[model samples]
Structures are given as C-alpha cells and as structure tokens.
Target: MAGWEQTRRRHRLVHDVAGDFARNGPRALAAWRPAIETEFGGLDDLLRDVQRRLHTAAEARLDALIEAPPADLDTSVAAVLDEVAEIYPDLRRLLDAHASHPAVAEGTVRFHRSVRTATGVDLTRTRSDRSRYEEKGPVRDRKPVFFARLRPVCGWLH
Candidate 1:
C-alpha cells in the first residue's frame, strides 16, 4: 500500500472512532468497564506476588547473615534489620488490606517467624505493643526494637 493511502486510512479510522464516541456518549465507556474491572481484580494477585517475592528475598538475606560469622555481628544485623524496617510498613499495610487472604496472612507470619529466628526479638510482639500506643495509626518512625534487646546477648551494639 502507498504511504499516503495508509495515512488517509488511519485518518478515516480516527474520524470514525470520534464519531462513534460522539454519538454514544457515556455508552462508549461501557465497552471498557469489564477490562477495567478485570485489571482491578488482578491487582490483588499482583500484590500477593510482590509480597511473596519480597519475603523470599528477605528470608534469604537473613539466613545468609545468620550463617556467616561476621566480625561485627551487631552492625551486620543492624544493617539487615534496617532494610527490614524500611519494608515493614508497606508489608503491614498489605497485611491489613488483605487480612482475609490466607496466602498473604501466611506469608506475613512466615516473614515474622524468619525475623524472630534471625534476631532474638519477636517483631510481632513489638508491633502489637507499639500498636497499642499509637492512636493515630501506623507509626511513621519504626526503629527496630531488636537492637536494644540484642545488645545484652551479643554485647556488640554500643
């Protein structure tokens, strides 16, 4: 086909679509509703997949830290826990939003369990205690309470 002919055809197609939307008004959007709904429905699944990947990576990182004998265990632990602190709020929000989802709940439980195993502190308990104090909602500044608790046992954190 000639280039000009193709351009003309595209212009006609665009005009046709514009005419349909003009005639149909709001009804033009009706065709898109199901696809939009499908996308919205898939968002939960996408979130779940992201959560799972994050948990897996965190768990592996923690395990590596636990297995190695770092010269400065406190600093190493602090570094990893700092990463955890960063992700905790988002993870908590996902948990709250999908509390009914068994997979999300299970992944959260597993992540917390891994943390407890790596650090002596049980974050779930810390979170529960902290939650009681914060009337406004999710605490903005989350300092991993594990450092204070781990200090006595390791004697490395000053």
Candidate 2:
C-alpha cells in the first residue's frame, strides 16, 4: 500500500480508538488517564524539539542560500521549497518510529483492549459485524483524506 494510505489507516485507527473511549466516557478516561497523558506529553515534547530543530536548520539554510545568490533565482527558490518538502518524509519517519516502539505499541494495545472491554465494541470484527454499529456510506465514513490541497495557505499574500 502507499505511504499515505498507511498513514490514513493509522490515523483512522487512532480516531476509532478515541471514539470508543469517548463513548465509554469518564470511567474509561480515568482508567487510561496516565497513559494518555504520558503519551501525549511525550508527543508534544518530541514535536517541540522537532520544531526547534527545524527552525534552526531552515534558518541556517536560508541564510546560506541568501548569502550565495545563484544565477537562477527561480531555481534557487525551487530548491529551498523542495528542501522544505523533503522534511515531511523525515517527520513521517520520526512519527512511524515512535508509533512502532515496543512500549508505545504495547501500551496502545492494552489501552485499546481496555476501551473495547469498557464499550463492548470490537473494531476487529468483519464489516458485516461492524455494520450493526456503523452505518455504511460516505456520510458515515471516518477515514480522513490523505491530503486535500483545496486552497492556498494565504491567498491574500498572493
């Protein structure tokens, strides 16, 4: 399967698990509170670190690119844009690494089981079994789009 497809599946699984926990309400939250807080806090810290490093790296590269004015300004601009685009794969790999860590995986499975037991819902069930709880069709679709570039970030800037 494509990388985006795998990423989408992972996100959907997270959403479904969250929904299950939500349905179970406060008690479920209480049961998994520590794990949730720890995991989310860890993720936050990781993101902050990444953001700081990215800022430093981008600044240094941009400074160098500015200092050395290439003959083709458009090509230089494109190179910078391409370099920024390349960061997404690195970020994805970092996330994938964190998700696949043994402790994280084990914790996730344990939490998922707890939520499933609390809610009495089995996400692993076949479509026919799931159909009882989940309505079919696009309206009921929970799968998120991989990437929907519907508009420019700041149209006003243009």
TM-score of 1: 0.38
Candidate 1: which pairs clash?
none
Query: Which predicted model would earn the best lDDT?
Result: 1
Task: Tell me the lDDT of model 1 at 89.
Answer: 42
Distance from true location, Cα of 58 in model 1, Å? 1.3
Report clash pairs, candidate 2.
none
- Tens-digit lDDT string for candidate 2 (90-141): 4323423355555445543563454345334343442321132223222223
By summed lDDT, the worst window of 10 consecutive residues in model 2 runs over 144-153
lDDT for predicted candidate 2 compared with the true structure:
0.39
Model 2 regions lying over 4 Å from their true place: 1-42, 84-88, 92-158
> What tens digits encode model 1's per-residue C-alpha lDDT throughout 1-158?
69766545433432333244445653643563454344434434534654664555455556666776477655554455445434344443433445567766676677678677776546665534223322334335665434333221111211
